[model samples]
Target: MPCIGVPCTKSLVRSNKHHLTVSFFQATQKLPSVLLAAYAELDCGGLDLLQGELPQSIANELAATAKAIAAPGKGILAADESTGTIQKRFDSIKLQNDEANRAAYRDLLFSTEGLGQFISGCILFEETLFQKNQDGVLMVDLLKKQGIIPGIKVDKGLETIPRTDDEKATMGLDGLAERCQKYYAAGARFAKWRAVLSIDPSQGKPSDRSIAEVAYGLARYAAICQQNRLVPIVEPEILTDGTHDIATCAQVTEKVLAAVFKQLSDQGVMLEGALLKPNMVTPGSECPTKAKPEEIAFYTIRSLARTVPPALPGITFLSGGQSEEEASANLNAMNKMGPHPWALTFSYGRALQASTLQAWSGNAENKAKAQAALLKRAKANSEAQLGTYAGGAGGGGAAVSLFEKHYVY
Candidate 1:
């Protein structure tokens, strides 16, 4: 028998031959076009329409977890600083700062009970990530077991700008994507990148170049993090400089944040999966008259709300040398007074850990008291996040002044 569309009769003699040939051609030619069209539609309308048409239960669960992490009254704990920074802090307390001490201190914070009630996640320094507790469990494992997501700070500290006498840029862009992938595999679900911006009234408002550079850096970092399936904490810190008043700080912060969001949008970052860690607006150290906590809270939130998008996961304020009580009080007031669009919480380093370190003084006997002090601050800040913090209750310990001229990178 002669074959149709085939050279051999044997080839054409297969069962359902005609249907098979048609199906093959359709898959080879027409099916690609059909798939392309579906993809185009998905690209235009996003996963919502696709999910509506084709059910994906996993996607829903992932989204719910993200929402819970960024929900109101919750914030991230930022413990991801370099050994050098931690050493500086340890030095202040007259303790022999070493890798062991660093690990111990972080283990203390991660092992605290009921942390998940307020802290949605923790950003861990590289050393602390793989370190084990006294019981030999990995710190990352400890955090996961307690329902807190572990994060890593990926920036490799700031580098001095070549010609700008006082300016610097954050490094760690080299191999960031791969680093993020490894961090994710190591139990980190998120990452943080901080770009420093200084207030230079001597040159008037921050230079357009400076603003654009930081914005672009943050956006690029966010994209890389998202590509690796890690949520990025985008932080463009407006350094507290000069005797500039709170109004000046607000203006500069607004400008910086606006630029950051514009770049974030430009880079196609998924805002729903990211967080913003920002400097709380406050007068500079040189500013003689300090604003009350209420004023600071009002201006800080008002400025942030003006610039940050509502789709952002959350906004965790950096203490920026504010006293522990001041930081908590300001956060408390913001929560109390707000019609805030996003959660206002803390990612403080010095403000949160300074007191605890002092109380500990690197002694084994002081462990319980140190842990209690740490928990006290954590509890106070947790309460502050809920807007019910009454001042002078938990954070009554003597304050540790970590402020020095140009303290940050």
Candidate 2:
């Protein structure tokens, strides 16, 4: 007898082979109309197999990927800021700022063994995305081989607002969605867009224009990311340029985050697949009295919890010019203060890179020393993620001397 299953030979052949098929018309016609009606009345909407489109297994894979990236006691390493920013950092350490040096520096970080122990993802700038290591391995491929998700920073640098001479706005909306598609094709599983805001008390509270602009910008960028299947790190930073106290900073941060989340919701963003990179609440550079690391952590967390929705995958605090030890200490304290609604961790740049550059000093022989320094800071911050940081107690008091008055840009 010929096979009657859906995969039978008759089904696989063209029209001429149909004579070999056995007809089921008699059986089909024997079914009662009432039985067919009852079958039609069954609500398959609740059935796993007939539910809206996405299969359960694929959905579960997406959820697992997001969880791994935003897992507690682990945070992303943002090596993604632009070459100019990295160059400025290298300049501070009196090192040569060239393409090869930059690649070497990044390679030093990526080459670290056991980095996956704490770092869940590494965000790369565009230049780093296409660069290869000395051994001829693509950086993105190398990262994925170690089980780390490779991400890309999508926004072009901030530009000066045309009419508002004092204010700056982030550009790159031009062709951004297409760019996101390209990045996704190039092995980026996530993308970042940073929007800058300044706190100008003299000019009054955050202007409606600035708030609306940033919120809309982030929401659009996030929507594009979702369409391309990339998780977005939405960062709307209220820069620490004023002399405001921690309380004022907290209030502004709350307002900014509230607006951001509202816009994200309005844009139908999937919060579960997104991460937030926000500035920790702290006194400004010109503020005479600086808060301790503990104070900073408490205020930052409290403010975030009040504004950021619980649905977000995670909240990664930006170091925002905090010293390495200070950033680590603050992160440790935040984790220590009881429970938080979301994973509290670091997306630091300068804080993580400063010591490494200082140790490297542009010398080939010092590569080991530089790598050791990078690993030490990475491990320290990793421990901080778990509230166990203990590296620089009583070494230097928390201070804001890093910023000079009318600091040269």
Candidate 3:
């Protein structure tokens, strides 16, 4: 009989029981040196946990940092949009996408009065990592002065997968360890790598190939980040595209997460030293039925409870397509329901900045207004983190879902 579609090699199995072993000389004579070297490097991360462990001091620090980022009533501000993406956003408001403009915008956000009360961290793009405010203080220093942790976005961006209509795999794993070391030395203590996936039942989108690719890439990314003393925020966003229902979204999210954890364990990743940035469970953008905040909370928490281990310190949700108020409402609902194992909070991008960006519109005179707008959104998210956000945190584009079809960055 055949097993697993391969002929059962009973003779080889029986031969293995004979305890016959080849000498090093015979082994080397049969296999070339290059082949042996190739076999060894095939597994990039030598996760020999049974033989050794990462330094305890490093582990402790990573865990402490993870906890601090998800501390009570605090959430992360994801201002890490790439240059092209920022250009698109600026275009929306008829602003020039100049370097100085970007610098000023980030400066306004980081220098917001009392922002640290709500935002514990700010994820920055490569450009903002080294930029300074007009006063000449490093942005990283600015954030640190306000008790905010500075994190870097390490992934280059997404690339289309071959043979797929529109599935993407995250790039920038090459030289990641070196980049993490540089970022860490420059005062960043955490990093993010975002991998995007989409759902389209008609086209059979989000194939198993895509999920597996994401899992493998993320695991490698996490290991490299930790080796360089930075906590990794593993963001595998299941995009809210198509016309799928909430149940479909939940199912795909669960499947992706299950594969992610498995890959993490296989690579010997320290669970306590990481944070998961995932999308909240919600209906697709084109779906007719809308889910209430409570329903969204139920499915989101259930999915995490099933796939995420208790060892993880936090699960910060990404507001991919939700409006500012909608995102706050959902986060508040989740916290209300979750005396959950891991801390649940927000790491939002557009949802947190849409109103602020609209308020700024590239005007230097509007800096104070921009800062105020940003602070208001941050406070709302902070309230949501604690399950106390009241009803009104509106944005001008409340009805427009931030769901760009095949959105890059």
Tens digit per residue, CA lDDT, model 2, 1-409: 3322234454443221223222221222223233324434666522113223333343333344566777766777888857667767777778777888888888877877777777788899999988898888888887787677888999887766655635656678889878888898888888888887877788874676777788889988987777666778899887777889999998989888889889988887766567888989999877899898778876786677568765565778877777778888889987776344466788876666666676777787888877777677777888888888876632342322344242212
* Model 1 bad stretches (over 4 Å): 1-66, 395-401
In model 3, where do residues sit more than 4 Å from their true spots? 1-52, 394-400
Per-model RMSD to reference: 17.2, 17.3, 13.3
Of the pair 1 and 2, which is ahead by lDDT?
1
**Which model is ahead, 2 or 3, in terms of TM-score?**
3
Of models 2 and 3, which has the larger lDDT?
A: 3
1-409 per-residue lDDT for model 3 (tens digits): 3222124455422211213221211222222223323433644322222214666557657767987998989999999999999999999889899898888888888889899999998999987998887899999998998999999999988888888886899999999989899999899999999999999988787899999999999999998888788999999999887899999999999999999999988887877778999999999988999999988887887677669876677888999868788898899988876455677899998988888898888888888888888888899899999999886765455434666776667
Best model per lDDT:
3
Output the lDDT of residue 187, model 1. 85
Question: What would the TM-scores of all predictions be?
Answer: 0.83, 0.81, 0.86
Model 2 lDDT vs. the true structure?
A: 0.72
Query: What's model 3's overall lDDT?
Result: 0.82
